[model samples]
Target: MSASFIEAMTAAAAQRPNALLTVASDVRPCTTRLAEVVAAGQRMGTRMIAAGILPGDIIGCMLANWREWLVVAVAAAHAGAVMLPIVTIYGAKELGFILRQSGAKWLFTPDSFRNIDYSAVVAGCGELSGLERHIVTGPAFEALESEGAISQPVDVNPEDLALLVFTSGTTADPKGVMHSAQGLLAELETMRLMRGGSDDDAVISPWPPGHVAGALSMYRYLCQGSPLVLMDQWDAALAARLVEQYRVTSSSGTPFHLSGMLAAAEANGHDLSSLRQYLVGAAPVPASLIEACQRRGLAVYHCYGSSEHPTVTSGVVDDPLDKQLHTEGRAIIGSEMRFVDDDGNDVPAGEEGEICTRGPELFMGYLDPVLNEAAFLPGGWYRSGDIGRLDAEGFLLITDRKKDIIIRGGENISSKEVEAVLLGLDAVADAAVVATPDERMGEIVRACIVLSSGASLSLDDIRDHFSAAGIAKQKTPERLSIIDELPRNASGKVLKHALRNCS
Candidate 1:
């Protein structure tokens, strides 16, 4: 295996010079052949060095999924600089926090994207102490590329820090999660082994470049020498067209992405026969959705992991449908998983408890030492803050998040259980269940729902639906609020804390 990302990318480019990294855009489609990608990356690396970027320096990038993003990412690795990918959806507040907290000296972003003037946003950032350079990607980047290429790539140790990705802060401020070059490369190797696909297979990546899923997909493409089709903005109809045009063979995203793709394909009569696998995660997944995708000849696999450690467990394409729908598969190679109680003692198999994991793919630690102290247990295991159970077959069934459960009166209710039942209904498009303040019961279950197109639902309707599903009465939502869309972070995870505060 390659020691660093630069080595892996250079080798892949040499083997497949003609392969392309295609960017799907509504304005215009763009592509960079492997040879050009390599050349540009080398040139940018040299420019970065000339600009006084040193090894171990953090360089922040807040750009969308485009050719420029890939070039800058590889260039950062080539320059031995640690990359900090900031989600494009972040506004000035989040941007300021990440930029200041990460101590990124140089930041690369587009002047404007999707009507957001990032240059203006950067200008408005107050008191970012370490940010000395703000480079825009269009014309400014071209001038930088005018510099000559470097003789060789910068030397970096395998264990050197490479990436600092922050978690989507739903309940609190985002925390930066660091990863070494060796750890991330090892993860790619494990993923390549588990999901075997040739260079000829085209993969569609709709995830934002800042998210770990998007970054990992880009690296996976380079590692496998596959053609990557990146979507700048997600539109289900446009995605369907791209999949048909590019013959996309594999993809990964949350259930929201899968659902949108299915609906678009069905409505537009797009042929999705070329799709071989769609790995779904990042939220509670409904079995009905998986069944629906399977009936349409799309292989839907459930995946489980977190920002701290990705791809802990993922269903295989060849697994039985029941397993795919019910479990998050077994522990991936190089990863160990265990269920534990609040005190960190291991829980017996088939018992519900918090999931703890230790793996080669795990992040080095949070940027804050205080946060790191609270993140791990006595062993090396990272507390996942998720509740789950391991079945006899070793498949993991994630029941709920540790903090997501609601206590109505004296009974505990899993919000995921109620949401799952709600999603199983034909009229519900999306749902998030959270605890609402109750005078008598202390806290009661309240559901924030997004109804299917042209469908309506009431509190009574939700109660009847839960009752029909045989869910416990306490778990049924006592109040329902129909909204146009559920509030979500960039990763497609519903912000339940936001829902809890909603009137």
Candidate 2:
């Protein structure tokens, strides 16, 4: 287990470098070849430190989705620095915490994406006093040239930090999830085993390359000697065109993004028949949505993953849409899953408990020692903090997040239960339930929602829908807020804190 992911990537790069790396809808080569790009990373890594950037430094990336991000990531790892991904989702406040906590010495960001001043954010980071160098990934940063022939990375080790990934936590602050070169690569092995990629493969995605999925594709797609097509932003119409035009075999995104693609398919009537897989995850995919994809001739594959443990569940072609949409499939080979109650005892089949796992896919640990110990419990099992159950078919069904459960009069009411019922109504496009302060019940269920097009829905309508679904009248939403969109993290999990603030 070398500490350099770029070293492993070098194998693929040497085999092929001019293969299309990224297809940006503009028909430009996203990557010429894997080897050359990685070699460039090695050279860039050497130059950055030569130009005074420190090794093992945390380099922040606050750029939009693009191929350059992938290049920087490889370069960072080759340079022996940890790539601290600062996605576009971070505000200046969230930006400061990640930069300061990761102890970033160099920062790379766009001058402005649309209207937001990312450089200004980097300048603002200067206020926190950790960032020493600022390099923009987009137009603002000066063009960078390779310093020299890619020097082999220095004595790399298995447990060294390769990336500092920030994942949302129950606590107000997001923690930096650390992944070693071996740990992250180990996680990708699960995807490799499941995908069994080939040289003829191609990937279509709008998920930003800054996160793990984006990182996963950097290797997974390259290993197959395939081309990757990327959309800089979530433009469904553009993405549909890429898939149709490129004869793309597969696409990936959160359920929200997939829903956007679905809408684009209806509006533009693009010939997505060329598409084979529309992989969806990060949020629950409604069975109805899965059925709709089937009607549209797109194979909707259910994939559930988090930044902490990417690509956990995947629906197969053989699985019925109901099971696909309902159960995250059994753990892939090399992964083990178990359900444990409050006492850490294994729960009986069909009983609800937190899903715990031990596999090559889990993150190395949180960057902070205290947090790592809590996240990875005794016996090396990582507690998912997600409530789930295993069915007779051995498929895992996630019930709700441990935090998303509403404690109403000390009775644990699953918000997912409320959402499931609400989504059953054709008018309800999506729903999220949270516990709000209440005088009588201590906390009552409140739903923030978005309705489907051409559907007129009211609070009572939603309540009755839940009632028909056999949901307890008490667990039904007492208050409702209709909105255009829910706040979601990079992984597509709804950001309830933002929702809670909408009072």
Most accurate candidate by lDDT: 1
lDDT of 2 at 176: 84
In terms of lDDT, the poorest run of 10 residues in model 1 is 405-414
- Give the CA lDDT, 0 to 100, for residue 157 in model 2: 69
Q: Candidate 1: lDDT over CA atoms? A: 0.80
TM-score of 1: 0.81
Q: Each prediction's Cα lDDT score?
A: 0.80, 0.69
* Predicted structure with the largest TM-score when compared to the true one: 1
Count of backbone clashes, every candidate in sequence: 0, 6
lDDT score for residue 88 of model 1: 78
Tens-place lDDT per residue, model 1, 289-363, is 899988877788888876689779988889899999889988899899888998889887789999989999998
Model 2 error, position 269 (Å): 3.6
Q: lDDT (0-100) at residue 37 of candidate 1?
A: 72
